[model samples]
Structure formats: structure tokens, C-alpha cells
Target: MTPNAASPLPPPAERRRLRESGSLTQDQLAKRLGIPSRTVNAWESGRTTPRGRKRKSYAALLAELSRSAAKVTVSLEKRPAAPEPAPAAAPLTPAQTFDALYAFCAPALVRQAYLLCGQRELARESVERAFQLAWQRWPEVAVDRDPAGWVRASAYEYALSPWHRFRPSHRHPEPPPPDADDRALMDVLLKLPPPYRRTLLLYDGVGLDLPETAAETEASTPATAGRLLHARETIARRLPELADPSVLHRRLAELASVERLNAPRPPAVRTGGERRSRFWTRAAIAFTVALIGTTTFTLRTAPTHYEAPVPAGVQVQGVPPRVALGPLSEAETQLRTKLRQAAAHGPERLLPVFR
Candidate 1:
């Protein structure tokens, strides 16, 4: 066997099995191997045999991917059965449990958030905030069926929050990734609605199954399928070169890895959460005290009874306008002369004739 002599290819069925185990589509593997999909299809279908360095390279790549897949399987298999009430060893303390969880999930979560929002600092911030909240709710998190999922949901929410647009620091767009393909992918991703973007990333980029993706996205299975399909279609439309969704998936992973996003140490996160909680608690107590003081002061100094307040005076109304008298009437003049003679009497006035 010379360096150019390639080992016999696996049977067609085994070829498909290895590819599927690695969670790779034919187009993606073809792209990675820098060959056409039809060539890969032919090789997998047992239609052709090419004896050269290419065969050796293809077989080696497949072997590498298969080993990775196997490792993942073994790790999953090693997980303790969920129903076990107690383990042989004493249960880990809350801090240990939280730290383990944070270590396991935070790095990937930060990368995912960065892809979601395209902001490195914001992505780290979102994951930190999510872990902080998780620590505060440790009892709930500890007993959760999927603690990673809980933290992931919180991180995604924070990263994609519309309210972030109002933040002064986030007002302008951050610089895009340096590579052209990465820049294009980020632009397309940011254009998608939050739900569709999240669905696509979870299903394709994170390699989650349909049902798991649906559960994480909080959508019905059918709805999740629809979103995933539409998201692919939209991205394909925006970037015709990425019409093959397998390429899109590969590109997504590449883009996420391009940034050196990292999560803070778990201890720092835990302490930060404690400090934030304390500040809010102290603020709430101060507000309550101030409210109570104001109420007591108002009660002590308040008037004893409901004294009616005097209303402000209004201008007088109903008086007729004055008019000048031109001359005295004839009857008014005769009455005045009679009154000047001093002959007016109360008996005459009461029973006076009608003269």
C-alpha cells in the first residue's frame, strides 16, 4: 500500500450512517471536502471509485467526524439516570451545581447569543445576566428537567430584547465580522424576526432535533417547522449563494466560532447577582420607609374635622343699568307740591280718595 493507495470505501449504507451520525448533510460534507455534491453522492452510492489522495482525505475526514460523534454519544450515555432519587455520593452543594452548569453552558450560550444579536459585549452580558438570574432562582433551576435550556431561553431573550435598541450604548450597530461571508450571514440573520432567527439557529446551528427545537422556542411542533422552513427560505432569498441549507448551517457555526466570545468566571457571576439583588432589596425597603413616613406625617398634621372652605367672592349681578330722567312727570310734580304743603297724613294715605 503506497501513500496514494486509498483503503476500500465503506459500503453505501455504512457511508450514509456515518454521515448521519456526524449530523452532516451531503452538501455540507461536499463543501467541506471541496468537492461537488454529485461526486460525493456517487461515492456514497457505490457508483464510482477514485483511487488517489482524495479518497484518503475523504475517508480520514469521515473518520474524524465519526469519532467526534462517538464522543458526544458516550458523554450523553454517561449522564446519570434522571429518576435516581439520590446518588451514592453526597449531593453537590448549590454553588458547585451552579458552577458546573455555568461552566458547561455559558461559553456556547454566549456564542449563540452573539449570533443572535451580533454584539460580542452584549452577548457576554446576556449570558452573564441569565446565569445570575439562574443563581438567584437556584432551587427552581436545580430541580429543572433542563437547566441549560432555562439559561438558554433567558440568554436569548436578553440578547434579542427590543428594548436594547433604546439603550444608549446599543444605539448604533456594532462593527460586523471581518470576513465577507461572515458579514453577509450576520446581516441576513439580523434582518430576520427574532423568532425565526432563533428557530433556525437552534435547529440547524445548534443541531437540535425538531421537537427539541420546538420546545426551546416555545412553539408548537408544526409552528416550529413552519418557522424553520420560512427562515431558510428567507435566508436563501437574501443570499442566493447559501441556498443550500446545509451550507447555511456550516456557515452559521463558522460565524459563531469566528468571534472569541467568553463567559466570565462563575464566582464573579454569583457575586454580581448577589450584589444586584441586595441593591434592589435595599432600594425597595427605603421606598417603603419613605412612604410610611409620609403617611404618618400627613395623618398627624391633618385638620381634625372637615371644615368647609369659604369660596371666593363673585361680582354682584341682577342690578338694572342707570338711565337719566328727562323731566318730572305731571303727576309726580303735583304729588311733590302736596308733600311740600306738609298735608300728607297716614289716614289719608291709607283711605285716600281716588282723586
Candidate 2:
């Protein structure tokens, strides 16, 4: 890789731009990354930065863009979401809600993945992939009621997704033999349905008490207790070797630690003028695609909303508008009250805003 002549330490603005536009253009990437374009713009303008695992997510976008630049078949398209405002409000989509919740519970999820997969790369990838899927279909996700529970549920689903069962060859050419202990554990864990696996992992692997587990899983206390009892019995019956909960926890933790050590490094940076040029090149390509796609789509179907309806307003296309909330209708106030009551002591309690 030719190093850019830009400063070795990217300026705050540049790093922000790279992080927000790490994949491509701000708008295009916002669409692909399942975030609002304004959020992307905020990051690029150095108003905010992605935190924790979100940093890795931005890295993942860069990795994807790098791959797309090299591959001919790769294409980026905006996934559709509910129509609504120029700038979306908090809780833009179900996926965004999931993203926030997943970040909060990442520590436990990482630990669970470590135990189940026995390797750091597999565990982290599993988490990231699960979040990506949740982001893709946030609209239908039950997260409106319980975001953390939704993420925990989604994580297990991702772990058991058919694509995950067979390791991607580019990374694991000669995958471990099926009879390996880790492999055996993975097979057993994969057999459990999402609800059971989630309950079992949170209770046994993460060591959350039934009440805590219920809150995290969005299940009632009784339901959580029942699932835990049933999951333990089911595991013992199906995987007799794993009847020892101690052995199961130990193996899972071992796998997780192995994965932690081998985590993939994020991409490199260009310096000075080179950095600017690189940014422009990435932006140009994304712009070209956006222009073509928008033009073609618009010609095919005239947009209900005009690009620049107001004067002196700079309008951008290809980004979805935010959900609009008009003056609170009477029904809106009643629903808001119920929502506030339900969310009063739930995941929002663990979140920074609510805290």
C-alpha cells in the first residue's frame, strides 16, 4: 500500500471523515451501514465519533469498500426503510435501536461467542454479522419493546445461520475437523433454538440471575426460569458430554479467549495530500454510482418528494428521510405514556441517556 503524504496521525476532521465515510460517500455509506446520513455527516464534520465496537463497524465498512474496489461484482445499494423528515429522530429504525442495545451487551455477547466458537475471530464476526442482519431488518424486529433482548435473540440466530456453520474458506482453508471438542460444542450449541440458546448462555455462560436474564432477554421472570430449566435438561439429554455445566462453561470461555487474541486489525491510513486525494477518489466513485442509480430510479418513478422545494437550501438525494412526528395527536399521547411506562425500568435503564 502506498502511504499517503498526509500527517501520520490523521487530523481529527480527517479521521472523522474517514470513520463516517470510511466505506464511501457519507450518504451512500449511511445507507449501506444502516445509519442516518445526518449521523454520517455529523461524524464527518467532527461533531461526533463512533465509539467502542462501532469503531470496528466503521473498519468493517472500509474493509468492504476495499474489497468492492477490487471486485467487479460487488455493488452497494441503499436498503429501504419506513418513509417519513429531512433529519430522522432518535430511534430512526429498529436496526438502530438494536445497534445501540447490542453495543451495550457486547461484553456478554463476546464472552458467549468465545465459549461457543472457541476462537476470537469467529466470535467477533458472529456478533458483527448478527448486528448487520438486525440493522437490515430493524423494522420487523421486536426491539421496539426490548432492544437488548432482540440483540441477544438475533446473536443466537446469527450463530446458527447456515453460512456460519461452514467457515468461510478464505479465512479457514482447512477448517477444524468435526470431532474436535470445540466443534462438538458448536454443533451442540447450534442445535438449540434461538430462545433456548439465548437463555442458556445468559444464565450459564454470562452468569446472569433469572431476573437479570429475563430483563436482558425481554422474557417474563417465569418464562426465563422455565427456559433455563428446559435448556439445561435438553443439553444434558442431547449432548451427554456437556451434562457437566462446568465443562461447558470452561470450553466456551477457552474458545472466547482464543478468539480475543486473534481479532482482525482495522485498516491503515494515508497521509496529507495523499489522504485528501484518496478521500476524493473514494467519494467520486460513490458519487458516480449515486448519480446513476438516482437518475435511473427517478426517471423510472418520479419521487413524491422534491429535491429542493425551498430556496437557498442545499438538497442531497439517495438518503432516506427520517420518520416524521406531527403535532401529538390525542392517541399519540396515550401511546407515549404506555411506551414510557414499559421502558421505565428496562434496557433504557442500562443505557446512558436514561441513566
Candidate 3:
């Protein structure tokens, strides 16, 4: 029945905006309000909200910040026309839009990927590859409901692909996490099946609701929930300290934070994607041309008529092989020669040379 408690505070984005505009770090705000920074993060991330006295303090702080931002906005609007008004900014082109998306989502996706696959290089590579794919399919992705989720799914799939283990670079294991506990936690995570691992990350680490996690994992809600529970239980059995979801969430985040992962620049990713696209495109054209050429050569060189193969020679059962004949007797030979000389109209030369 209190006024501050009765009124709703800003939405998640606005709360973050107000805090940022007020020039207060989450740590500073938490210190001033005597709350954990994690709680502040959760609220800003829309994962949780403060309650009781903390809610009131947080709400009042945001309202003051909002009012101050409003005054600044008004003053700026009133004072700001240049001698010549500036031209309106142009809308972002697809490339610019794609680049912006990459810059915004790549870092966090890389960290998420690290948690999905323990290899640091693979984690970074997967995100970059995902962004590349997004750029290639920019039109589709731009119109997507959740572009970040799309990119995240791509990255996670790549990082967790069974094929990656067979890769030359992954033939040997990378160095283990510096902290023994982190290494153990990572090993435990890696031990879980990919579906369960992804489910846990989507639900616990990324804060997706069960249905969303299920949809993303392409599983029924029940199946997704089961996987999540099983994954958590397995981890807890190995690492009892992470039995609680909240602690596990925080620990997973900490694990990601400790890695030295950095994604390539957006322009580089875009360029790489374009180059890859061109390579494939050209390769396709080349393949088509070669196929056409091969087809033409085949058509030209192929036999027009089907020539039946010769049958194998076989002996006739009813007949014997003929004996070799000797030359005719001398008189017989002479008679045959005389007959040929007297033959028909003329000799062989006058016979029209049939050839």
C-alpha cells in the first residue's frame, strides 16, 4: 500500500538507460543502495527484480535519473539548431546494419560459445563464422524475430559439432583452465551430451525461459526440461557447489568471463564472408562450365551407332578342322591361268577398276 511500491518502474532497457545516463556504474549504484551488483545485473538483464525496500530505492533512483535526462533532453532541443540545420541522417544500408548487429552480438556470443565448447579458439571462430553466415543471409536475418538468437544458435552448433573434434587443431587438447575449479567445472560441462549442455546454457546461463530454450533446441518442452534437469544433476553430482541454479548461473558467467576470447572486427568478418561467398560463387560457375564442357565432349566423342561386341570363337561340334591344302598340280595350275587370260571382255585393268 506504499506509493513507490505501487508504481511500476521502467522497463529493463530504460532502467539500464537511466542508470547509464545518471553516470552511475552498477557497482556504484549497488554500493549506494547496499545490494549486490549481480542483483543489479539481473534486474537490468530482465532476469529478476528487486523487492521490498530495495525495489523502492531502485525505483526512486531511476525516477531521479529519468527526470534529469528529461531536463537535459529539453535543454538540448531548445538550444541546438546550427546556423544551417544539418541534413537528416540516411537510413543504414544492409552492410552497415549487418555490421552493427555483428558488433553488438559477437562478443557475448563468443563467450557463450566458449561455455558451449571449451576450446577458446573454436569459441571465437564459431562466432565469427556465425556472423559471416548472418551477413551472407543478411536479408533473411535482418527480418528475423531474434537475430541474436539466430546467430547464437549457429555459433553454438558450430562449436559443439562432433566434426570439430576430428579437426587437426583439435586433435590435441588445448591448455586447461588456469583455475583447478574452473577446469573441473569445464570438464563436467563437456561431459554432458551436447543437447543437455546447450539446454543448460540456454536456460541457466542465457536466461531463456523453458519454452524458448525448447524451441531453440528444437525439442519438446518436456524433453528440454528433462535435459536441463539431467544436466544440472550431473554437474551437481560432480560439483556440489553448483547445485543451485543461481550459483550455477553466476559460476557459468564467471567461467566465460575468465576466458581470453575476442572476436574479429565486424568489417573483417563481413569481408571474409563476402570473400567466401565470391569463392563459392566462382567455384560454382567454374563447376558448371566444366560440367557443360564435359557433357559437350561426351556428346561429340560418343559413338553414334551401338557396335555389338564380337562373340567368343567356339568349335563346331559336328565338323572337324579342315586339313591344310597343298598347291594344285602343275597341269591344274596351268589350266586356271589360261582361263583367266581368256576371261570376259578384258583383263583386270579393263574391268573398270572396281575400287
Candidate 4:
């Protein structure tokens, strides 16, 4: 036999037509397409169809398969090229990052604050206030190891602040029903020192490891580890259910929903439009106060007394052209007498100038 006898034949659309007429399976199409059976199946079933560069290869294979059959031939053409993929979006800006981060952390911070303060609205307010501060300090925080932890710490501080703690809420949201177990655990955690609370929450709650936890709290690994160990042991003794992460998660989730743990929050201090508004408000108020003071002073200190010109006509003997004092002298007894008579007779009884 010649070497050419062993050579494989070309595939063509005629092979596909014959196969379809014969009701042959995708396995036969696979032989024709020179592809795996699954890919042929995908093509035939319309799950996917080849195009672009791959279509050229498919057409060549089909042509080769057609030549071997001899009974038919069909024109081969490649499919059009596939559309290009769209470009990816740009990365988030620093301000955008802060906003996203605040949104992600608000609910958690609120739950933590609630645990500490036992007031839902106060806790929410604390978290909102904390995010407001974090937004202002985003430059310092966005790069720092644990921005979320920093925000939570700030929230805790705000929750415990004397002013915030004592202030009454005139318009408070309805108090949510308490989860007894969560409140008990939170009670224990809240009683822990700030260092322990920071360490434990970063580790057990935020899922941070020792080094990251240490960085967040500005403590050494050993110190953070120690605090975490102590905190865990304390919590475990009080609430053994925390030993299982699942239980802890369920409890936390319940708290989170109520607190809106994941809600977007504002920055701590005024920035952007808020900053401009505060500045202009203070400036306007200052200007108004200054204008009022200036007006009052001008009205108060200005000389009130003035002389009308002596009416033309009637005679004046001697009386050395009367001087026009801006106001009457206090020491002149006659002036007092003239003031009293003027008051009694509505100025008609007072002696007049020559005219």
C-alpha cells in the first residue's frame, strides 16, 4: 500500500449534511469537526458555536471530511470575528474608598456600640459620628493596616463620651427586642478593658490574625495575642457558645441587621459642602452680630441735642449771638429749668432765642 493511503481525508459542510440526513450522533460530528465529542455536542445543540479564528480551523476540517466522501461538496467560509471585550472600570478614589469602607462597616460598628451602651439609636448615632470622623481622617486611615478597626474604635469612644452618653434623644427610633444571649456576651465584652476589646474584636469578630490585629491596635503580637487569649477565655467562661463560630455568627448577624451594620455612613467632621456651609454660616452670623453692635453703638453714643436756627425777624438786644451747644451743659442751672418747663408745657413755656 502507498504512504498516501494512510492519509486522513478533509471535512466539509457536506459531511455535516450527510450526517444530519443519516441522523448520526454528535460523536460523528466530533470526527468531522476534529473536536472532542462534547464540543461537537455543544455546537449541534446550540449551547455554543465556534466563530472568529476557530471557524477557519473548523471550515478546513469540514473541507477535509467532505473530500473523503466523494458524493458531495459544499462551499466553506469562516464565520465573522467575535466582538472585542469592553475595557475594565477605573479603580476607586481615596474619597470613594472611604465611603465604601464606611458603608461596609457601619452596621458592625453600631452593634458593637449598642453592646457597649445598651441603646440602639445611640449606638447607631455613635457609628454614624465615627464614620464622619473616619471620612475626614481617611488619608491617615485608608492606608493604615485596619481602617475598619480604627472606625470601630472611634465609635466606641464616641459611645462612651460624656456628652453623648448623657444627652437625651428627642427623636429616637423604636427600641428593638433584645437578644438575651447576645446582650450577655456583649455585656461581658464591654466590661473588658479597651485594649482587650480592641484585640478580641479585631481577631474573633473582624477575622484578623495576630499581626494584623497588633497593627490595628498598635500593640506587639505577643501583647495582642495575650489580650485576645484573655478576652476569649473570659468570653468563653461567660458564654461557652462562642467556642463555635457558627453560633457567634448567628448572634452577630441578628445584631447586625438591627444596627444596619453594613449601611453607608458620613464622615466624622465637616468636609466638602458641609465644611463650606459651616464656615459661611459662622461668617454670616458673625457679620450680622457685628452689624448690630455697630448700629447700636452709633445710635447710643451719637449727640442727640441740636439747635434750630433762630427764626428770622424779631429783635435781640445784646444777648451775644447765642452759641449753639450740641447738647445742653449739665452744670447750667438755667438749662435744667428750661428742660423742666419745656417738658411741662411741651417746649412752649421755655424762653426762646431773640427771634
lDDT on C-alpha atoms for all candidate structures: 0.87, 0.60, 0.88, 0.64
Q: For candidate 1, write residues 39-150 as lDDT tens digits.
A: 6776777666546777887888778867888899999899887856655888799999999999999988999999999999999999999999999999999999999999
**For residues 1-355, could you state the per-residue lDDT of candidate 3 as single tens digits?**
3335465788899999999998998868878888656578778888777777888888888889999999999988898466677789999999888888888888888899988888889999999889999998988999999999999999988998999877898888889889999999999998999999999998888777777899999999999989999999999999999998878988998999998788899899999999999999999999999999999999999999999999999977978778998889999999999978875763554654566
Candidate 1 lDDT at 257 equals 91
Error of 1 at 303 (Å): 1.9
Displacement of the residue 260 alpha carbon in candidate 1, Å? 1.0
Give per-residue CA lDDT, model 2, range 114-221, as digits (tens).
544444566666666555555545566543675555666666656545565565642453354344666666666766766777788777665455677787768899
Greater TM-score among 2 and 4 belongs to 4
By lDDT: ranked, best first: 3, 1, 4, 2
- What alpha-carbon RMSD in Å does predicted model 3 have with respect to the real structure? 12.4
Better of 1 and 4 by TM-score: 1
Q: Evaluated with lDDT, which candidate comes out highest?
A: 3
- TM-score head-to-head 2 vs 3, winner: 3
Q: Which stretches of candidate 1 lie over 4 Å from their true place?
A: 1-90, 308-355
In candidate 1, how many Å is residue 152 off?
Answer: 0.2
Q: Which ten residues in a row have the lowest lDDT in candidate 2?
A: 263-272
Candidate 3 residue spans exceeding 4 A from truth: 1-51, 54-86, 306-355
Residue-by-residue lDDT tens digits, candidate 4, 115-199: 5565666777777777766665667988878687788778877776657534466245445447676557667866888678767
